[model samples]
Target: MEALKEVYSRSFFEQFVKVVKREYPPFDKNRFFELIYDQAWPDRELKMRIRHVADVLTQTLPPTYEEALGILMRIAPGCRGFEYLFLADFVELNGLSYYENSIKALEMFTVCASAEFAVRPFILKDPDRMMAQMLAWSTHQNEHLRRLASEGCRPRLPWGVSLQMFKADPGPILPILDNLKQDSSEYVRKSVANNLNDISKDHPELVLDISKRWYGHHPHTDWIVRHACRSLLKQGNPDALGLFGLGNAEGIDVRQLVTSTPQLKVGEDLIFSFHIQNLSNDARKLRIEYEIGFVKKNGSLSSKRFKLSEKMYPPGTSSVSKKHSFKPITTRVYYAGQHKLSVIINGREAALVPFDLMDGNP
Candidate 1:
C-alpha cells in the first residue's frame, strides 16, 4: 500500500504553484517552485516539504500579512488534498504579527484542509484571545470552521502539540463544546466528542459530570456523549457503562472455556471457544470483551482489550467462538513466551487462561 504522506510529491507542489499563479497573476511561480524544489527535495519528509513550501511562500509572496493572506484566500478554493494544509501552515509561520488576519485565514483555509493543527500555536501564544476566536468560530456557518473550533483546542490532539494549559484546567473549553454539542453536522459533533475525550484523559470526573448532564438530551448529543465516554467505558467506569445500558452481568457464568492450542507459533491464530449462561430470572444487558495479556520483552504483561459483543442476554446460554491472529504487524510485535487470555462481562473479569507463544521453528 502507498503511504498517505507521499501525497506531498513534486507534482503536488507544481499544482500548488499553478493555483497560486492562476489566483494571483503577479505571483512568481517559477521562483516559488525553484525555492521549494532544490536538489534534495525528494529526500525531505512530508512535514519538512510542507515547511519548505511555506518558506517558499514567505519569500515569493508580498511581505505584508494582508497581501499574503489575500493571495492565500484566492488559492484556497481550488485546494483539494492534504497539500493545502500549507495554507494554514503559512498563516502559523507568518501571521502571528496580525492575529486577527491569521484567524480569518484559518477560518477560510480549513474548508480546504484542516487548520486544526495550525491553530494550536496561536492558542498557546494567547489563549484568551485565541479561545475567544474559537468560541465565535464554534458558531460559524461553515462546518469545517466549527469543527476547527473544538478540534484546535484539544488538550491532546494527535500529531499536534499538546495543550498543557487545557490539560491542567479544561474549564475554558466547556463553552466551546457546549455550543457545538448539538451541532447539525456529524463532522462537528465528532470533533466535539474527540475534544471531550481528550479532556476525559485528564479530567474524568468533569467529563462524567458533563456526560451526566448531556447524555440523552438529544439523539445527536447522546451519540456524542457515548463516543466521548468510550475510553472511560473501556476502563470499566461504572457510570459510563451504565449510561450505555451495560450494567453488571448479574448471575452470569462462563463455562466450557477452551483454547484450540495450548502452545502455538507466532503468526498463527489462537482459536478460543466459550459459553456464557445467563442464570438470572430477568434479562441482562452484557458488554462482552476479551483481554490479551501480551508478554513484553521486559517480562511484563501489557493488557490489550477487544470488544466482542454488546447485546441483551436472556435466561439461557450462548456460545462465543473467536479467532485472534498473532500476525506480525507494524503496530505490535509478538514475543515468544507465556501469555494469558481472559473474558470480561460488564466490567467483571473471569479466571485467566494461560497460553504459550513459540517461534516458528520451535
Candidate 2:
C-alpha cells in the first residue's frame, strides 16, 4: 500500500494539523474532513465542522474583536461552504469591528464566491448600509469589487446567493445595480448582465427599463440588455421575446395558475403555474417558460425567470395550470406589489398575469 503521507504534501498536512490542533485540540482532522467532504449527504457535517472551527477561533484568538477579525482574515483560505455559516454567525454576533475592518476581505468573496445562506443575513440585517457599501465598492478601480456589487446581488448568481426578494423590489440595491450596468470592466459588465437576468424573473419592468435606458448608449450596454433578456425573448415576449424576428404569429390562449404567498419569509417555497394552449390547427413544436416577480425590501418588484417546459403541441391542445416550485432565497427580500408573471410559448408571443408572494407558514 502507498504511504498515507503520499496523498497530501507533508507541509500541507502539517499546517492542517497545526491549525486544527490550535483551534480544536480534540478534533480528528481526518474524520472531520472526511465527513465534510463526503459527497453523499451535503449540508449536514458542514455546519458541524464549521461550528468546531468557530469554537476554535473563539478560543485561539485574543478577546479583542480586532484580533479575532485579523485571525479570521488570515484563515480565509481554509473556508469551506459550511464554514462560511460559522463566519456569518461570528460576524453577526461579535464582529462589529470585524465587519468594519474586513469589508475588503468579505467583499473579496461576497462579490463572487460566497454561499447565499451566508450572504443574505448580512443584507437583511442592514440593507441600507450594505447598499452604500456596495455603491462605494462599485466605484472602486478594482474590477473585482465592481463585479462583486453586481454578482453578489444578482437574482440568479450561479452557485452564489439568489436574492429573489431583491428581484422584486430591488430599490435599495437598484442604484448599485444601475451603477454597474454600464461599467467599464468586462468582468464587471458580465456580472451586471447576469444580475439583470436574475432580476428579469420578478421585475421585467425594471429589466426593460434598464434595456431601454441603456439601449444604444454603448455596444457594451446593448450586449448586456440582450443577454439579460435572452430568456424573455426566447419565451415569446413581444419586446424581449423576439430579437431574432420570431413573433407570436399563431394565436394562443393563456391563464394564470398558482399565485405567490401573500407574505413570503426568507426560507419558503414559491410556487406558480400557468395554462397555455396552441390554437393553430397543426402540430407545433413550442417552448413554454415563465418569469416571476419577487418582492424586494423597498417594496418594489424584481424578476427572475424559469423554464416551465418545452415540447410539440397538437392543435387545440393546452397544457393548463402547469405548476413550478421554487424556494425563496436569503439575499432578496419580498415586498408587496402588483406582481406580474408572464408565460411565453414558442418564439411567437407572451401572455401575462399577476400574482403575489406574501408571509405564510410555507
Candidate 3:
C-alpha cells in the first residue's frame, strides 16, 4: 500500500490511490499497482502524462475484459483526449458502469454520435437497462436523446451493435420506433431508418407494419422504408417482396422471414441463416444483402451494412447463408434485436429473412 502511494507520485493514479489508500486499499497490491492507470483530470500537463500512460498501457493490455473495465472506471474525465481512450479502454474492459455512463454522458459528449456509435457491445451485456433506456429516450425533449431512442433500438447499427443477438428478440426497441416514426430531425430520422433496416433483418412484417403505417402518416417514412429495406428492395426477400409488391401477386407465395437471438458480445461473430424457395417454375436471380445494427450505450442505434451473401440461384433452393464477425472495442452491449437478410432481383423486393441475436461480451 505504501509502495503504491510512493509510485503514484503526483500522477493521475496518485489521486485515486490517495483516496483509496485512506479508505479501503486493495489487497492485491503488487499486481494491482502494476496495472498502470493514470487519471486524466483535464489539466494540460497531467493530461499529457495521462496520454503517456494510456500509450504505455496499450502495450500491456488487460488479459480479460473485466480487468480493463476497472482501469477505465477510475479515470477522472480530465487529461488530453482521455475520454476516447477511456472509451477504448472500456471496450477492452467490457465494463458494466461504462454502459450506464455512456448513456448518462451521451448529451455531454461532443461526439455524441460517435459515443452513441461506440456503446452497443456494452448494452448487449445488459439488455434490460438498454431496452428500458431506449424506450425512455424516445420521450426525451432533446433531439439527441430522442435520436438515441431510435438509434439504439436499431437491429443493425453500422460499426456499433452486434448482429447475432438482434435476430432473437428485437422487441425492446419497438416503442422507440413507434415514438420516432415521424421525427422531424433528418439526423434522428436517419437513425430511425437505420433502426428499421436493422429490425427488417428479423422482423420484416413488423418493419412493414410500422413502415406502411408510417408512410401513411408521414412523408418521411418513405425514406426510412426505402433505406430500411434497401437490401430487400435490391434483390428479393419474400416479406420485403410482398410488402413492396414486387413479384407475382396472386400465386403460391413464400412465408414470412424471421430472425431470433438479439444480443452479441464483443470479439464474437454472429452467424445468421434463413430459408428460401421459389414457387415459380423458373430460376431466381437472388441478390442478398445483410446488415448489422447496434444499440448504443446511450440508447441510440447505428447501423453498418455487411454483404452477407448474393448470387444467382436456381429455383427451389431451401436456404441462403451469411455471417458477420465483430470485435467490440468498447464497453457497449449490443441488444439482440431484429435482423434482416433481404433477397432482391433487379432492384425489386423478393424475400427477406428476419431474426434477432445475443452476441456482445463473450
Please report the candidate that would top TM-score against the real structure: 1
- Each model's lDDT comes to 0.87, 0.60, 0.54
**On a 0 to 100 scale, what is the lDDT of residue 110 in model 2?**
43
lDDT (Cα) of model 2? 0.60
RMSD list, candidates in order: 2.4, 12.0, 15.6
Q: Give lDDT for model 3.
A: 0.54
**Stretch of 10 with least lDDT, candidate 3:** 1-10
> What ranking emerges by lDDT with the best candidate at the front?
1, 2, 3
For model 3, state the Cα shift of residue 276 in Å: 30
Runs in model 2 lying further than 4 Å from the true structure: 1-64, 75-98, 102-104, 108-119, 155-165, 243-245, 248-346, 349-362
Error of 1 at 189 (Å): 1.1
Candidate 1 clash figure, as a count: 0
Best candidate (score: lDDT): 1
